[model samples]
Target: MNPVIHFEMPYEDRERMAAFYRSAFGWQTQMLGPEMGNYVLATTTETETGDRGPTQPGAINGGFYGKHPDWPAQHPSVVIGVDDIRAAMEKVSASGGQVLGEPMEIPGVGHYVSFMDPEGNRVSMLQPLPRG
Candidate 1:
């Protein structure tokens, strides 16, 4: 497992927002094109040892940055680490949930999908690299 996960915050200026985070938190980011869509991964690290310690890894999952030029800004949404998005979606639909976004790859990372549960709290899921 990737341990910690991240959330997506809708920004008016994605580039500027990303820069702000990088500067403020010392977060390393990398642009993931095509396969991962137009999103960047935020990397956390351990300052003392400079290793993927209990706190951070060489390149953990970075939050995705984007703009909501249309919808009104709402509560921040966190993406949870899921085992299987498709199977989970099936379970969601079987109950009373609805799938919002279909399964999509996160560049060379993994896959993710968003959906609403029976209670209606906004949530997302990401399937990280399979265990070797």
Candidate 2:
């Protein structure tokens, strides 16, 4: 079964959000510059490699994105890891879900896409690239 691997939430101020998380939860934050769309990576666990995953089981990390007016349904969402993105997209459609758009490459991360489930909840799926 696919697992819920990551979560995402929109933030208006990157630094303020980072500070709040760091102070409240002691979560580490990495601020990416404009080259990467000003995305802030929020690390919630002690992992062997940042962004790879959480070292502890049942613990997941997430990131924060800059909120945009044009972006629809900017609510907190969970990301599921899938083995085959293409097949998963098909399954979503077949099961009364709607794939948002074409999957996009996330550099060393993987191919990622968002979709709306049968309940109209916005969720994402990711197919991580094989590590050598």
lDDT tens readout by residue for model 1, 1-132: 433366665555567867888999888766666554466666655433432222644334445656545533334677777787788788778988787867877554579777777776666778777644
- Tens-digit lDDT track of model 2 for 8-62: 9999999999999999999999999887789888889887664557889988989
Q: Please list all clashing residue pairs in model 1, or write none if there are none.
A: 35-107, 36-107, 42-62
lDDT to native, each model: 0.64, 0.91
How do the predictions measure up, each by TM-score?
0.67, 0.94
Clashes of each: 3, 0
Candidate 2 minimal-lDDT segment of 10 residues: 46-55
**Model 2 TM-score?**
0.94
Task: Please state the error at residue 76 of candidate 1 in Å.
Answer: 2.3
Q: Best by lDDT, which number? A: 2
Candidate 2: residue 94 Cα off by (Å)? 0.6
